[model samples]
Target: MRNTLNQRRSTRQHFRLLEQLLVATILLQLLNKPAVPVLSTLLQILLLAWL
Candidate 1:
């Protein structure tokens, strides 16, 4: 039925969004790792971007 198909489409969209969030979180953690002292770097980048 149309309802079932719509449900499947919504589920798929949720799954994809979750996957993207997970990947982005992992990437952000990697950037913020202590070895990099990345908070300062990030702040500098943000300042430059804001300007």
Candidate 2:
């Protein structure tokens, strides 16, 4: 039972890390593109954070 709990904990941690990386990558891409307006970018960031 303890081993199972540890496994689940590790899996959750991994997923959270992946989610953060995905958000960062998307934000970076948006920043790199010159056409994205500031309001849209802020909205996108807020949306991602909400998720």
- Which RMSD values do the candidates have, in order? 9.8, 6.6
lDDT by residue (tens digit), candidate 2, 1-51:
999999889778866876685666678677786544654566567557645
Q: How far is 21's C-alpha from truth in model 1 (Å)?
A: 0.2
Worst 10 residues of 1 by lDDT: 35-44
Output the lDDT of residue 17, model 2. Answer: 71
Most lDDT-accurate candidate: 2
Task: State the lDDT at 44 in candidate 2.
Answer: 62
- Could you estimate the TM-score for every candidate? 0.62, 0.62
Judged by whole-model lDDT over C-alpha atoms, candidate 1 comes out at: 0.63
* Cα error of candidate 2 at position 5, Å: 0.4
lDDT of 1 by residue, 1-51 (tens): 999999889778766765665566567777776634454465456446544
Candidate 1 TM-score, C-alpha based: 0.62
Candidate 1 lDDT for residue 19: 62
For all candidates in order, the CA lDDT equals 0.63, 0.67
